[model samples]
Structures are given as structure tokens and as C-alpha cells.
Target: MTSFAPDSIVLNRKLPLWYQVSQSLRASILGRSPQDSLRLPTEEQLAGHYGVSVLTMRQALKELEDEGLITRHRRRGTFIEPSAQRGAPVRLLGSVDAIVAQQSGMTTELLDYGTVAVPSGLAGHFPQHAEVATYHRLRSEEKTGEPTNHARNYVRPDLAERIDPADLIRWPMTKVLRDVVGASISRITDTVEARLADPETARLLQVPLLSPILHYTGVTYDEEGQALDVAVIHYRGDRFSFTVTLDAH
Candidate 1:
């Protein structure tokens, strides 16, 4: 059994004590200090270490059980379920348009289109102060019409100046970026995280709140390593997974 140390307090500004404790335990199980099957410490021990009541600790553990992160048995105790690892990256032509074109029945729905002042966070990533053209899109596959992805993309004002929002519905942004703006994508930086779908997103995607999903934030650069665009993509967890291969030298 793995025991929680004295400093294992879970921090949550908005949640109740039990939820906070649950989140803390969940993080620990997912990260370091993981305990294998039949190796979890008793609820009393966790309660003491986290300075929470035993009932609170039990509530926390219950949440984990509901999420399938842990399994609890009457006499055998609780155990962590090994998570499924992601797969190798699918190489799209370094272009979203190319990727979409390869998928036979995928369709894009232009959700909202307009120019907006660059957010400070987004501005920080860009080299200079420039109005950013923003596009929000929902992508669905096959005849099911079930949304598989939600994307929010940002482009430099000058590059996107002549872009018609309607054109985006017909042609993917990757083509627009390359053909219309004459920019070639040279590199991309991607960051992935496991997250629960928010309320609005859950409704849009026809999934329950707290449903697991993959969140991706990426920045694409031109041949000169100048940032061309930034995008955030959310993919359905059960329907999609990614793979990346590494070469050992």
C-alpha cells in the first residue's frame, strides 16, 4: 500500500472539501506515487495524511471509482487501473486542409468568424502587435454528424485580411494559409493534455460533462521559423487517439 505524506493536501479554490480531496488523490494516482493493485492504503490513513475526515476521504475515493480510475473491493482494497497509452502521430501534410481532404467524409462547420483584438496570452506568443483574425469550427466525420473535433484558430490580421469567412466553409484554412497568403508551414509545436469536457463543449459534442477528452494546443511556423498561426483542438476521447514514434540513435 502506498501512503500519502503530510503535504498531500489537494488544492481547489471552488470545489468542496471532498471534491478537493478527490482531485488531489486522482492527481497522485495519475502522476507519481502510484500504487499497484491491492496496494492502496486504507481510507483512515489517507484521511489522516490529508487532514480530512474519513467520510470525506471515502467520498473522494468513490469519485475515483466512478471515473474508473480506481476499483474498490470489500476485502482486497483499491487499485489503480493502468491507462491506455497514446499511439504514434499521424502525419498530415503539415496542413489541416490536407488532413481533412484525406478523410473521406469529414466536414467542417464554420461556427463563428470575425476579427478580434489579440488576447494578451495569444499576443505574447506572436512577435508583434497585430489584429488577429479568428475562426471557430466544428468538425464531424461520416454520416453520423457527430462532432469529432472543435477548433479555434487564429491568424495574423495582414495574412487573413482578404479571407472571406464563407470561403473557410468551402476550403480548409491550411489551403488558405498556403495558397492565399503564400506561407509554407515548416514546423509545429504541439502540447497535449487529458481533460474533462466543459458544459458547453459537452453539449456541442453530445457528450456528458466530465467525459474524458484530449486537448491539443499547437503553433505552426513558417520556413523561417516565424509563427504563422496558433490553434486549439479538442478531440473526442473514445473516437480518436494519437501516436508518436521516436527513433533511438
Candidate 2:
């Protein structure tokens, strides 16, 4: 019996064999209780379940491990790792879990809110616009209350009207895009670079003027490739960092 969506390895034979097995295990791992989250099916049982050899199952486990989703114990079983916060030296490239992480609650300081032109050379990026709702937001780390990211977001007016003012201040932009604006995200693109924090940015971010900062500019697009929102984030270099893992494909 299949345990999760996209886990029907028997029916989806054309797909990569090991990957389906991993999704099935991923479902299992994520669903388990905290006490049982540490326990995993033996590699032999998992291999037999999908009619694959232990080597094939091991390969799938390696994929999960490299993603920071699991850890293996010598002479013991593998265990699930806890989730990490999304705000940071934000992942220019996102994983499935990282996308989910973006929706968690975080406090925000609303800087500016109003309508604005779509801007020159960006007409193709918007779904439709001469004017759209624009938001300037500053966020802090959830637990420590330290500054996290300073972001600006622009959404098409028709879609932007659905967003509640309160929700925009509290919810992550990713959630507002999906839940309030009802956009089906096709893909996201962003570039990370280093730059000096200007006076206003330094004051809002609580960093010294002219301090070096890590900056990111990102655009989210719909399935049709029309832009949903364009965002730029500035992260303090001292307080934030990204952990990048290299995976063998």
C-alpha cells in the first residue's frame, strides 16, 4: 500500500527508482511522532519494501542526508533533523522544506505602504500594471528578536487588494503570495551579493553606517512566467549566514 502522494513507486516506474523510495520514507519520517522520529526502518526492510537492493535505498538516504533532513548513527539508525528558520543569508536556491519554512510567523516593522509604478524595463515582469501595492518591511529573528531581513515587495493591484493589512504585517511574503494573492508559484530567481549599508538601511537594520552587508534581489513568477512580486532583502553580514551543502547528482 502506498503511504503518501507521489509514493506509488509501483505505478510510477518511469521515475527514478530511488527518489520515489526516498519520498515514501520522507513522508514516513515527517509523519512520525517526536519519540519515534528518531527511529527509522532498517535499510533492508526499506529496500525490500520497494523491491530495490540495499545499495539503492542507501543512495536515497544519502540524498536526504545531504539535504540536512536526516542524520545517521554508527551501528544505529538514521534520525530526522529539526527544521531551520528561513530568514537569513536566504537560500538563493530553495529546497521543498525551505519553501515551507518561509511561511512561519515573524514580527515585522512596517516601513512604507502605498501604490507605485511598475518601473521602467520591468513591464514584462508584472502580470498587469501601471500601479500596484508596494510594501516596505523589516523583519527580526523570531526568538532572539535580532534584525533579520529588510525587504521590499510589490504585488499586482488586483491581487494585492485581497491582502489584509494586518496579515501583510505579520505573515511571511511567501504566504501572502500563495494564500492571500492566490498565486501559483512557477519559480523564483535571486542574486546574492555584498554591498555597503547606506544610512537609512543601517538605521533600520541596526548596523553601523557603511558596514558591509549581504544583499539579495529576488523575483517570483507564475507558471506562465509573468512576475508575481519583486523583492529585495538586505541581511546584516555579522548576524546572518547561509549553510550551503554540495550534493552529488
Candidate 3:
């Protein structure tokens, strides 16, 4: 049996439990050697390991099954798919550095730029703020020109004032925060969920209505712990595989 380190399987309560579990298991599945066929722990055991309920663990396993990473049989337990693709491209989570590297080579298109009153939906994320600078950007593959991501960025008015539109077209928002806004980003908290595309998002990404999308909400904080930026990004699930690397030690 391959045992995952405790740090490797730790879950963030802020994110959906099932999504975190699924991503952890996906990393393990894809990390397996081609000749290694391993049977995974029972739902109850996995639930215990991750400090989640069995029902939650079951939901996590179902996500893997949906992705064809594992097969579950009554009385026989769950087993990894021997033919699962290895070295698949996946979006690495839990690190800003990794994220910046992953975004390299992608083309960015600025869709909308304005300073507007914070919408009711985002009001809570930016408490005490009535207005913010908002930028809508669409990202695409440089070669294929296929749209991969759409991000709506709400920045603190002061920081937003320093951002150059041309800089956004050239680099990721985090880089802009550090270099242009001079905000010392000390931490970033991100939560991800699977959602169906709304009409506007569907049209923007050129996907069919109700297509499955990966919704990411991220908040970046400065050294003093004040929220500097809130980003709501939608990624085409079909175009990206999300992963979190686990330490074997």
C-alpha cells in the first residue's frame, strides 16, 4: 500500500471538502507508475484519514470515478485505472510561484476596464469599499487561440490606480500587484468549486450554455493582512486538469 503523508492529504476547511479530496486522489492516481496498480482505501478509512465524513469521502471517490481514474466494485473495493494517462498537464494549486509559471506563454486579452460600485455579490468580499477598479480579462492559448480562462479582477481603488492597462496584458495580476502597485502580498487564499456556466460566462468563453466550469475565488492580502485584490476566475474544465502535488516524505 502506498501511504500519503499527513501534510500531503491535509484539507482546507474553507474549500469544498469533496473537491479537495478529489484533487488529492487525482494527484496520487496520476503519480503512480505505469506498472503499479493500487487499490485505494475504503470510503470509511479514507474518511477517517482525511477527517471527513464517509459521505464526503464517497462523494470524493465519485469524482475520481467520473474522471475514469478509479473503478469501484462491490465487495472488491476501489482500484486505480491501469491505463490512466501519466504526465498529464494539470493546474498545480497551493503556490503562487507555481501558478505564475503555469500561466507563462498564454495570451491575454483585456475585455473590460472600469471603476464601478462593488456589486452586491462581491460587496462582502470587499467590505468597507463602495467602489473598486474592475478589469475583465480573457486568456487564450497562443498557438491554438482557444480561450482557456476569463477573470474578473476587483482591486482596491488605490492599488488599481497604479496598474497600467498595458501591464495587465503582459503579466499575471499578482506580478502587477507587487511591481506596479507596490503592494507586498503576504498571503493568498483561494477556493475552487465546480459550477455550470451562466449565459454571460458561456458567451465570453465561447462555450455552450450550462457547460461545466471551474470557478475560482481568490483573495490576495498585503503584509498588514488587508485584502488587496479579489479575483473571480472561470476556467474551462475541459481545457484544464487541476492538481496538488503531495510530498512522499
Q: Quick one: best lDDT, which candidate? A: 3
Residue 85 lDDT in candidate 3? 44
Better of 1 and 3 by lDDT: 3
- Pick by TM-score: 1 or 2, better one: 2
Candidate 2's residue-wise lDDT over 42-137, tens digit each?
Answer: 788778777888998998899778766678898988766755232323333243224434424356888888898887646677745788678888
| Alpha carbon lDDT of each predicted model | 0.67, 0.67, 0.76
Local accuracy of candidate 1 as per-residue lDDT tens digits, 1-249: 455332365343344667657655664554333333335688998888778799988988997787666788898787666551111122223224324333323567999978888878888767685678889988775345667778888987777786777777766676677766688887678788889999867977778998998897878788888777788888778766665433232
lDDT of 3 by residue, 18-39 (tens): 7677766676565444345478
Give the lDDT of residue 203 in candidate 3: 87
User: Candidate 3: where is the Cα deviation over 4 Å?
Assistant: 1-90, 246-249
| TM-score between candidate 1 and the true structure | 0.57
Q: Which window of ten consecutive residues has the lowest lDDT sum in model 2?
A: 2-11
Score every model by TM-score. Answer: 0.57, 0.62, 0.63
Clashing pairs in 1: 87-242, 87-243, 88-243, 88-244, 89-243, 89-244
